[model samples]
Target: MSFKTIAAILQGEQEFQRVLDCAIPLASRLEAHLVGIHAEVLPVPYTAAAGFPDTDFIQVSTELNKEATLKLRGTFHERVEDAGLSFEWRTLESFSGDGTLAGLPNVRAADLIVAAQRDVESDDGTDVESLVYDAGRPVLMVPHSGPILSSFRRVLLAWNGSREAARATFDALPLLIEADQTDILIIDPPESSDDTPDAAGSRIAASLGRHGVSVGVSVRNSQGQSVETLIQDRLAASGADLLVLGAYSHSWLRELLFGGVTRSILRSAPVTVFLSR
Candidate 1:
């Protein structure tokens, strides 16, 4: 299905506009609605046992939060307008702790979520940090410090014979269809079909070609290294601004373990990565 609405989560950071820049072209190509969202950290609940002095502190803190929200909203709106895209801007108010990713409503309605990947040291446990895992949708995570991709001219699809990768391919169909050149690069594809389960890669390429995407397909050995490093190197070497692939490769251990490629991309992704789990 085509994406009709694109939602971007912002925190009024210096790189917020860059996130917008990366998303607008996708929105324009899909002719989709764009939305910019910022979350407001609500006041911490105060109990009677905390005493009168603590109550006063809570009130002052709440006021400061409100003022910060207003300023952030104003600045965000101005930037969204400057991008020449019609956008709805909203400040989400939630009492959940920062690690909770406070804006589920925004995630619920968005077809895609655009966010800047943040590190543990940089994150104050804000909603931004959880957008990737909790959004329940594909997240096109952009690096916090990097060049904004102007267009999807060159793209690399990190393919493996897995269901997650299949889902990610479908999620990225819109962008891939519009890309100037698209390549389905399977790192160390099996020697025979027996080792590799049949996948939707070829079908996706055909579908995109029907929609005018320049497509090429190839599979190569990753030489026994972690698949993640190989994929990152391929993306950088190909000058691919967009990398589309699955988010998690395995989860049978009762815990989430990102596939090698997924983890590597998270740490040193040179460009934008569109992922669906």
Candidate 2:
């Protein structure tokens, strides 16, 4: 499937420009309708110890939010117009001040979502796992610091033959079809009664091959290395621009409590990561 509508979740000023740096060109190339979504925080009423309202606090908060909202809206429009792409700009005001959360309705309607990795120093972050798990769509996360390529030449697809793995592969078909090379990497593949160890990633490789993806498979023993580490090394070694994987292959609670591959990679990875639930 091709992307017809692309939503760029602009979390804040510091990082949204970088996200648009990737999204604008992609939308232009795909000829998709691009939507920029931002949300302003609604100030809550403040009261002093004497039960009197703090007008200064409320007014300052309100003005700051409005200023930020206006600034982002202006920048988004200017970039889209400069790119000459069909687009829409959405703005919202809510207590959470989360652009991603506020834009859920629009995000659900889009074919794909683009989000950025969090920059802790600047508080430029979003609940990206929600976008992956809740959006019922594929999400491409750009690293807060990395080389953002106009086009992905090599794709590293982590496959384990699980339902989630299968979902991510097909979801990434549009890019896989266009990529110069796609390596299906399976680490510590499970021993199956019906399939041999050597045949682990072959089926999916064949499936993607049929879709015009130049594909290959790499089955390896983790050798005491964590799955996330092995995957990271593979991306760097292969010079891959993209890493596609199933998000939360384990149960969400288990992953959250004990730590898991999804969380590890999401926290930091050198390449742009593509995820699907």
RMSD of each: 3.5, 1.4
Tens-digit per-residue lDDT, 1-277, candidate 1: 7888888776655546666777777676667788877776667766566454477767887898878777767876776577666678767766763322766666669898877766535643234425655677888887767777745778898777588888888788877876888888876655565444244357656776787878887666656777777787788678888998787676523233434546557656878888887
What TM-score quantifies how close candidate 1 is to the native fold? 0.83
Regions of candidate 1 where Cα sits further than 4 Å from its true position:
28-30, 45-53, 95-100, 125-129, 192-204, 252-259
Q: Which parts of model 2 are misplaced by more than 4 Å?
A: 120-123
Candidate 2: residue 103 lDDT (0-100): 77
Candidate 1 lDDT for residue 57: 67
* Candidate 1, residue 164: lDDT: 82
The CA root-mean-square deviation of candidate 2, after full C-alpha superposition on the true structure, stands at 1.4
Error of 1 at 141 (Å): 1.1
Candidate 2 residue-wise lDDT, 139-177, digit = tens: 989888967765798999999878888888898888898
lDDT computed for candidate 2 = 0.86
